[model samples]
Target: MKQGFVKVAAATPDIRVADVWHNCEEIRKLLSEAEKEGAKVIVFPELCLTGYTCQDLFTQDILLKEARRALERIAQQTKNSGSLVFVGMPLAVDGELYNVAAALNDGRILGFTTKTFLTNYGEFYEMRQFRQGPEKARVISYEGQEIWFGPQLLYQAEEMNELIVSAEICEDVWSPVPPSIQAAREGAVILVNCSASDETVGKDSYRQELIKGQSARLMAGYVYANAGDGESTTDLVFGGHNIIAENGTILKEARRFTNEMIISEIDISRMLGERRKNTTFQTAKERNLPRISFTVNLEETRLTRRFGANPFVPQNMEERAKRCEEILMIQAMGLKKRLLHTNSKTAVVGISGGLDSTLALLVTAKAFDMAGKKRKDIIAVTMPCFGTTDRTYHNACLMSEKLGATLREVPIADAVRTHFRDIGHDEDVHDVTYENAQARERTQVLMDIANQEMGMVIGTGDMSELALGWATYNGDHMSMYGVNASVPKTLVIHLVKYYADTCEDAELRAVLLDVLDTPVSPELLPPKDGEIAQKTEDLVGPYELHDFYLYYVLRFGFEPGKIYRLAKIAFEEQYDDETILKWLRTFYRRFFTQQFKRSCLPDGPKIGTVALSPRGDWRMPSDACAAVWMKDLENLTFNKTGGYSL
Candidate 1:
């Protein structure tokens, strides 16, 4: 598979108790479908050959003999299939009965991975029939074949080096220390479970959490195939819940009471990268276990997995609200710690009525409240220059007053004009110097005011701005502590709206709602027809697009081409191919050129997984060349009609 993406499936096929022939046919049908879907790895539920309801029937020698024959036939059925398949069955070795998952690929059995932990308590009577499987590596003869049988067996793909797989039973993952952990430590990037878990009042949710936590802890892709409908319901009901997860994110899940297959593409490279970054995730030096290597035809896997356009922000409303609250609390707590440690009596913030500054002011008020200080101690400064509008200026003053903070307005028109005259710059000319002059003047005012009032200046620049280096050096970019530093522009909108809905003060809510409606702008240039003309998105690309670019680039280390492909899929309906490419190029150019400003970023709390804080999460050279990235973009071919050739 190209880009280390392997298509995998978890299937729950219909089963009948002690009916090996019928079950084998069902398995064959599902296997055929999966192979047709281009699945390289497919897993079936536990004890599917002889249904889990076959309780005491598991002790019968006739069923065992038939199951062995059925397994051989199943292996033969997959001789022409391309996938590496795992099937559950009962096996007896030296008079000891064991539950195992047989790994089959091409015409023969690769190995047998026994269930390490047997569920015997409560509703399960697995221990009544089968004993705990052998923990050490061992070989056993079954069906006239010597299969490597043990709990520490790992199956590796011949062509792809990262596709190392291991397996355990249903209850093994519930153990205090799962075998998956040791298997991962032995370099298994994918874990499979042949599970027959029954459903209860809240067990489904708990089971989902268990699988997600285990996958995250092991840093491996987990495929859980559970016994579903048709399993005997003597004491428990099987829901047939199958899941495919990777690194804590559930990629695909099946509905309960359904005999269906859940398929998704696994990015093995991303998991390996995560493991390599986390030094504390230690591995064993020498596992001293046997590895069974098999070959699957090397072919490109067509991905059907969906990548969210906005990875930093949750799409669900309730989840987004919860995340916003958590991030806000973290920001406030960070500021509170600094205030307490410094023994400062006040916090100085520049109120621009923009999303980032508004959030900074909100966090400052929260920090003051947390420190048991009056909100009046938070000094909100508004500096109006040539580009000042009645709407933003009024909103800035109103927000400060409604929040019970002390508001101070310093008009910088005369100060800037005097400075412009001193520098011999034309008053009518609007250039970088004209705009940066206003930004530096505002920062100078805030810094001096903070010194005068015995407080610290809170920065309002967000992660998106920092990524594109859209801040004036030593201007709005510098602060005593940047509460919104790690937060991105797309998430900032929701955070502000979340505060507006939750903050009960009616006047404060009204001001916040208006601020959310205002267009994002620096307001450095004069107004056109008394309306703001200096829009940030028009000069740069959209913040939504830039934030998307920032996440894949910093979080997963994806190359330009891969990110472009994913972005095209995620934003297909919202944006066109040409528009995406145009902004994408802008994003790369600005992101590379703006690293100098980020190299010396101010102290800010890291609020999420992706951050541009120079002190944490990111460390890039300021002068690094963008030639390699640009070359990749240049190599992207365009059609005669101007669209991407792809």
Candidate 2:
């Protein structure tokens, strides 16, 4: 697979009770389908060769002999399959029967991992037919070959060393201490469970949570295969609830009672990255667990995993709302601490009726409320420069009044004109100087006003701006406390919208809605026919794309090429390959060159996992070069051959 994304499958094939030959054919069909889907690792339910409901038939010599022969047939089928398949069967070792998962690849058995925990409760009679697998590594003869047979066997991919796979039976995962726990501690990044779990009143939900939680705690990818239709439902019913999860997120889950195969790409690279970052996830002295190394054809895995266009923002509405509320509280609490610590009389925030400033003002008002101070003590300043439009200015004035904050209007056109005259610059020539001068003047007004009122200036720049270094240096960049510093621009709009939906006052809601509708800009360039000019997205590219790039690059440490691949998939309908590559190159260039602003960032609460706060989450050298990143982007060809020259 390409980019450390190993395609894996959790398959549940319909089984007939004690019909080993028929089950082998079913396994063969599923294996063909999975291999066609480009899955390198495919797992089947526990004891599927001889159905879990076989009851007393499991002890029959004829049935055991047929199961072994079926396993050999499946092993031979792997000669041309090119994918590793894990199938379940009963193995007799030293006159004791044990349920085990046999790993087969390349015309032979890679290894056999016996189930360490056998269920003996309620509907399960596994312990009656089998003994507990040994904890230590051992060898057994299978088809005249010495096979590693134990619960501590790990099948390591020789090509992809990070893709070490381990197996456990159904009850083993539900045990107090799963074998997968030690398996993960021994560097198994992917854990497969050959499960014969029967569906009960609410077992499916609990099973899903168990799989998700274990994968999260272990920081590993988990594949669960359950027995499905055609099994003897004498006392219990199997639902075949197959699930594929990676690091707490279930990528694909099959419907209960259905014979289905769920194939999804598990990001081994991301899992390993998370494990390395977590200091508590320690690796113990290797149990000297016998490892079976195998090789697979190396090719770029066509990723079937979906990447969200906005990773920073939650896709679900309820989740997004909850996240927004939590972020608001963090921002408010951070500001409240500053207000109480400094004993400031007022909180001054310059508002342009844009998303970031509006969010800052809202958080400031909340901080004042939390500190048991009057909202009027929060001063909302609206500075009208050369390019200020009627829409934004009107919204700003109305918002401050409705929120019961002291509104201050400072017109800066005259001051800017005087300064330009002093510098002997033409007023008609619009350039970076013209734009930055207005920003500096506005910041200067806010600072002086805060000093006059015995308060601190609350910054409105967001994380997206910090990443792209979009703020004017020493202008809008400096502040006493930045509430929205860790918030991204894409998420800032949602925060404002969340406030609108929750606030009971209709007028405040309407004004916030209008502010959300306004074009994002600095309002430094002159207006055209009284309309706002110099849109921020037009100059710096879309904030959404930049935010997407920022999230993957910072959170997952993804390279430019990988991010580009994910972006093309995530934004296929909205943006084409050319547009994605164009903005991606711009993102890399700006992000590296703009680290100075982030290196000296103001105090802000780290609201989410991905943050640019220098004191908290990110600490990067400002002088680091972007040459390597840029060169990778330049080399990307972006064609049908998976977008790279390699």
Candidate 3:
């Protein structure tokens, strides 16, 4: 019931063939349960009141009269329930019978959307009994009330925006053009289907896929309830399958052949945003569409769908491997083209044995190979300064040699010492200037060497770095072409390991595995007693939290409060509420203040869905005000070093 979120359900109730009274009772019971669950709209199977398998019995006046009477009973039972229900039944319209999904709510029939595509092939002989429905809706008298009955009928929720719902019959969805598509164009946020699709070998998967794709195509919430476990087994098997999906994602699904109710909240906000962003979706809006109006009470709904803390990273191992392979190829191929197009035989990459640099160097090797150049053409430069660690230094040199790249070390301590003297800053003071001086000096060395060698300077800074403005402008931030520009820090580690695991060299793989295990740091400050200092997370925020913030902020344009709400669920075990909010504030502050860095980013491949490349996804002004965002975060009240404000 939340603004832009509507609770919807797909219900498959067990029933007997030709049992109108019994089936109507089951519908009533399910309606009561769904309403209690705060479901605004619930859908049942096709011809559910009279049962889809009631073959020749549909022609009998008694069965047809019973179905009409049962529809009345179901409609009457909805008096105490607030849910808009879509239950299937047989209907006689203009002296012809058709399968219709009647919309019932608050003891009244809102409308009936009849099936347009009557199945007449194979085990399905729907056309034998019922004929195709008309395209245009017409008013009909049902239970002493006039209601619209046809394919194009939309229910408008009186209390909610974008909570409009519509219904379609079984074969209507299987038609060349689904009613869901038109329903969406007509502003129906929710599309319910009453399906009595008989199960066959591999039919469940196809049914599932069809519904999911339609939801995605329409950018609407799709609730599919199929008839199951009941009806005649003569030549057809009905395995009741139910699913609730939004934006192509199936949030809740029942086991095939089981009578169950699947419910989930549909974030119309996300779908609406996607449709607005895609031009094809916008074109669908221009066509004139007919709609039947219905309404529901507006109230806040509880979130049921689980949010992933690391949405960028896949949860399953198989998907993760696939994603890792795909992203690695994308990165390498991007760099490959840049090198071949520029006719550069050598690539200049600054390596510190850190994740970002290591990934960049690997990509350079792949790019050179793709360009039909030797690996040594990649000029791997390790600039050791005040913060350089022996472990990373050794690893950088080893990694370069292992990849057959030309390893070169340039000590920047002497040059930074001179720059420190010029800036009148003491080397003892570890500040932004101290760190940025080493960064800029290293960049100068790489750029000049690239110019001398006639190569491209590879950039190691990732999207996470760019989001926080972690790089020094015209220093590490500048490069000829950045392959990891769109890659987030959370994903960079995974991609590196993915490349490592597939390497033919075991030693190289072992070293990469260790690098993956290493803590993330710029390593700008000198080590404290041989231990690495200046861990990036300690200064800014955890990449996990910041990545979460960046994703929701840019991907969905979610408000800070909504993002915070989702974060609690996503990171429940890893982080508490207070900790999440604290880092969230940090993310907003740094992201706003660092836009100046992103404004002048060098050429980089857009690798992911969310990117802030000046020429790509994000084009914000460097000086945009974050005052309002920061103020909202700052005002978040928490307990005294405890959990959220309870």
lDDT of 1 at 416: 91
Evaluate model 2: give its lDDT: 0.90
Identify the superior model by lDDT, candidate 2 or candidate 3: 2
Model 1: lDDT equals 0.90
Candidate 1 local lDDT, 174-233, one digit each (tens): 999888888899899989999999998889899899999998998889999999988887
Worst 10 residues of 2 by lDDT: 637-646
Which residues of candidate 2, in runs, are more than 4 Å off?
285-287, 638-646
Write candidate 2's Cα lDDT for 430-495 as tens digits: 988898889999999999999999999999999999999999998899899999998999999999
**Model 3 residue pairs with clashes:** 1-301, 2-301, 154-292, 155-294, 156-294, 158-295, 158-296, 228-240
State which candidate, 1 or 3, has the greater lDDT. Answer: 1
Per-residue lDDT value at 452 in model 3: 92
Clash number by candidate, in order: 1, 2, 8
lDDT of each: 0.90, 0.90, 0.85
Which stretch of 10 consecutive residues in model 1 shows the poorest summed lDDT? 637-646
